[model samples]
Target: MSELPHNWVKTPLTNIASVEMGQSPDSRFYNLNGDGLPFFQGKAEFQTVYPEIRKWCSEPTKVVERGDILLSIRAPVGPTNIAPEKSCIGRGLAGIRSETGISQAYLYYFFKNIEPWLSEQGTGSTFAAVSGQFIREINCPVAPTSEQARIVAKLEELLSELDAGVAELKAAQIKLTQYRQSLLKAAVEGSLTADWRTKHKPAETGAQLLERILQERRARWEAKQLAKFADQGKAPPKDWQKKYPEPLEPDTTDLPELPHGWVWASVDQLSESVRNGLSKTPNTDQRGFPIFKINAVRPMIVNFLAIKHIEIDKSEASDCWVEVGDVLATRYNGSVDLLGVFAMVKDVPVRTLYPDKIIRMKPVTGAGLGKWMEVCGNVGLSRKHLVARVKTTAGQTGISGEDLKKTPIPLPSVEEQKYALAILEDRLQSILELELPLEMAFKQSTAQRQNILRAAFSGQLVLQNPDDEPASILLERIRAERAAKLELKKPSSRKAKVSV
Candidate 1:
């Protein structure tokens, strides 16, 4: 550690603080009914200074007093929050208190400086965690009380400004997202092609195109049935076409009017099939067929790297295998944000199947159908439709295959669909390019925050006043006071023998 400005003391936390590790109370004491005190388990709702209280404890155990530093100690280790009031903390956290001559704010800032190092040092098998002994052994640079206060005051001033800048950048990114979604909505509704429509006319109107596709859809089904009948060496059944299930038509009651060459269509009318994938729990082994986790499907982005290898053969999971141009939709999720998200299968380098929590929609060949479906599913109205149908059966927010098949979307003639998608892609690519620098700036600002903390602790941020007492003298007084306190707690020899 760099030398502190003339009067600071660098010492292990044992000298200037006490560590109180938390322990969970009985399950019966845990309640959401606002019983006794707010309960904090891990880092679920942790924020800048304090954790937002949700669950409460009827009977408190392992409590932290107000202003104590609350440290997360399990799974994700080394983050800290402060206690706003006396509250119960579970095994995931430990409370720290500053001793005499040290500011609690200074201690909190010191912890913030060392977070990166602490994260690396945490150890465990199932979940990485830090022991109380590890926390106590960490060295903290202590500034004299007055200077500590000065440093904290300056940091808060500078950091508040930095935080504001970061917040603005985040808001900008959100605006980009909204703009992207709006572009897709406009493209599908033919707003983007309004000028193009005045110049170029489609050979087939949207209604006529829909009629042609429906005829093709039925013809394929009839051919499959005919082949089956021929294999049986018997004549085809009379009126076999009557047995074909008609594709679902969209309900246009509440839908808005489409452009002259466009019409509303159900996903079922546009797609050949809507089906769910395979389900096998405890199937991550990095061998056999690759299976996509729900995370692999984000809005217009599918990452094959976020996949697991399940111990199932390609043959056994044949029906679940995804081909190129297929659309994957998140069938169920805990977060509603992911409910209607869709991504197209660009390439299957290795054959893969999706989980049951994902629904696959294979569009009728030709007409840029797969990409159009992916775009339509992620549009604003479709998102609202999917969110409205979400059912929470046993703690999951999700949609059914039937829901995907019945969702309404605008359909344009094949020529117009291709043209709109090309324009939308060009605009969206520009937005993606702009986001690159914004994402990097967010990361850089976070590093700058750490730099500010480093400067403050190194005594480069605030000046030292020679009139202030040196930390060594303050430490000696604190030590003496602790020794006196320890002495008073000891039993005299005569009393000890009597008790024994």
Candidate 2:
């Protein structure tokens, strides 16, 4: 689509290369014994520049020679790799070899530049696939053989430098993740607020706070019992405690020590309740009650933009409705890292109900405590514990409500927690500022690589050499060579008469 050199010309790919679609051999002929030839089915065998040999075929069907460019034609559609050795190729791949006056490397880069277009051309009901004709018909900019060599050399030099920069940015990203984890570890371990604690004493110890929470819980349960009896217009049960048992205290054997005025507690002791959300699928009506799925639970906060609406009546779904400051966690995911990932609700645009894949918790102490718990659930020590408890089945990892409730949490005095949280927020914000730019640069490097390829293919990457032969002359030579080859393959008139 861009301007090209005066000596360059545009030509169909078939003019310079032979395209061949591969046919898969019978599965009975497939083997891993290194018997006949290495077999490549598709992208699964593809590496950076060449296909990695995994399985071998005892009875080979279609084959590609060494240095031939192999293209995946199914689903992914456009990744190209050079054949390192003669190999059997399956139906999911096609091979291209230079006919004359073309470099295999130049063709590889040309295909690389138009990968997006090739992917768009793919069509299939079950999975996207392209035919051999598609490859043959695709137009490519042709450069003189000498100019192509120069362009490829310059492109590789520039791309290698860009790739190195991207690698550095990725390394920095990994370090940033490690740093954030360290910051959370420090917050929960009491080391972050050790200096602050020395300057300002806590108003109340963690043990005293827990005692007050227990008393409040007992009183609230008793009040609920009285209200229920009043509503029924019946005498109170003589032994209502049997029906509504008090919550059990968690065992803290072998648990790690906490700072002075701090204690170890379970999620159940800290939260008013931990429960899973509605199990039914939501209706498509956008005006209906909004529902949050596992995807809505992002790091630190819930994402309300991608929410779906349920058709259930507002009054009927009230029990599963969530409010601000409630901590939400993914109850199950195909990835273990995503399982039990937590987020706290901030602002709601509409009344929202969480889906079954998410579990919601309301802290008994305060919203600040809920926020702290959400952070703890995602990082270091506590995260390792949670991951260890995850049960996996059929590729999905899950943690039950009871298991979540039993998660051990480090508790500091309310004042110290507030202090530590402020520090953690400031440090994490600094890390984010650093992270965002690195991520943007990584994206830019990818775009830069694509630009280099585009320029190289359009004959803009290297200057045209007037002394070099023009592409028009090279193409005429290739056409003449192909015509001679076709003449050689044609059957003689005498041989045809003898056969008759």
Candidate 3:
């Protein structure tokens, strides 16, 4: 603790405020019928005041008045909020009530400064918990009633400005994310690079490219089929001819017109092979086969640094192995919104995938190149398709393998697809670089404002008056009142317990 200047005083946190622990009512008896009072849990107090809570209790004894500060003590600790009204809270929260000498707002901000330390002191095997005793011992700075009011006023004014700037930065980030999605949607539909295409002569339509790729893949399969037949010196099966597939037809329902030399088709038509990843437990070897989970496959690029590895069985290596350029799609997940998420592998030290969860599709031909496929997967059209086909349950939702096979994709000319992807990457990167400094400015502004509040509340912000009553006199009066109360509560003598 630093030495106080003039009339400034320092005190323990418990000396200045009252602390109360929370308890949960029987949750089985909880109802949304609105007959009882609102109850808050740690999660509900993170930032927003949960106006309508799913849990409630009839016990009026647990009710807390408005202006009381609530802090969570479990799972996610340090989430703080002011009680909105007469409300009850769960065991996860500890309520702090301010005395006349302290401002609620001042204490709230002060708690924010100490929350990290409290979290560090939390102890538990399953989940961290901040005991009530630990909370009571936490220390903070306190000033006179008038000084508390001044600090609260100055903090509110400054915090409002910081909050406004943070809100704007967050909104800008959201808009940027939306714009990126829109750009991808437009690119795959040919609108983003259509101007360039209109000026150039048509070499081939997208349908023609798909047809050409189909022919190339069929020829490769047929050659392999014949080679096997010749090696056996036996007649090929009659149904084998029927088993051969026909050329894929363009799906006109795929919205937005395709550019010349581009086409639309079900994702199944482009892939010769498709299956889920491996399910075996992965080995933690530093240099081994690389395996990806659903999280590894993000929007456009696969994050290779997060790969896990497993000791490969020879058969698994021969059949289900992943290679560079293979596209993987998440099939089963609780988050239905992430059902159709796709990513292409760029480098692989080892072949890996979990069985029955992620679908691995190796394109028959080169039409599904890395750069173009990334744009196609994240494009707006694909997202709409994913939303429609994904399976949704009350608590969870996700896409299935069959749904993934039917995902509608726009085929772009190999040359134009490359160019469009390059432009999008450069433009998006530049926008992010331009916004980085604005983000920094917002952080610095808040820090400077907090310093102002600290100074004001500590009496350094405003000059003191020599004629005014000193804080020492106020302390004496408080001590006198406490002593008088203790004198009246002197306990009657009872038989003291001796060693058993």
Q: Give me the candidate number with maximum lDDT.
A: 1
What are the RMSD figures for all models against the true structure?
3.3, 4.0, 5.5
Q: Write the per-residue lDDT of candidate 1 for residues 1-500, one digit (tens) a residue.
A: 47778798788898888888999999999988888999998877689889999999989878889999998888788899999899999999999999878899999988888899888987887879988888898888888888989999999999999999999999999999889878988887789999989998889988888888778777877888899999999898788789998877776787888889888888888777788888785256787778898898998888888898777665868788888889889998878888868888988887778888899887876436889888888885666677788888887778887877888878888888889889988999999999999999999999999999999999999888999988888889889999999999998768544654
Cα TM-score per model: 0.88, 0.83, 0.79
Query: So what's the TM-score on candidate 1?
Result: 0.88
What TM-score does structure 2 among the candidates reach? 0.83
Query: Which residue pairs of candidate 1 clash?
Result: none
The most accurate candidate by TM-score is 1
Whole-model lDDT values for every prediction: 0.86, 0.85, 0.69
lDDT of 2: 0.85
lDDT by residue (1-500, candidate 3, tens digit) is 24555665666657667788888877664666766777876765456433345656666335667878888788767767888777887888888887655678878877765555566776788998888887787766666666666667767787787778888878887788787777777777777887878777556666777777677767777877888899999778877756676644434564766566777776677777667777777765744566665677676666666666767766775656667778877776766555667777777754455444667877776434645655676556766777787776565567766666667778776667666877887887977786787678777876776576556545666556665455555555556766787888998678778998
Order of candidates by lDDT, top first?
Answer: 1, 2, 3
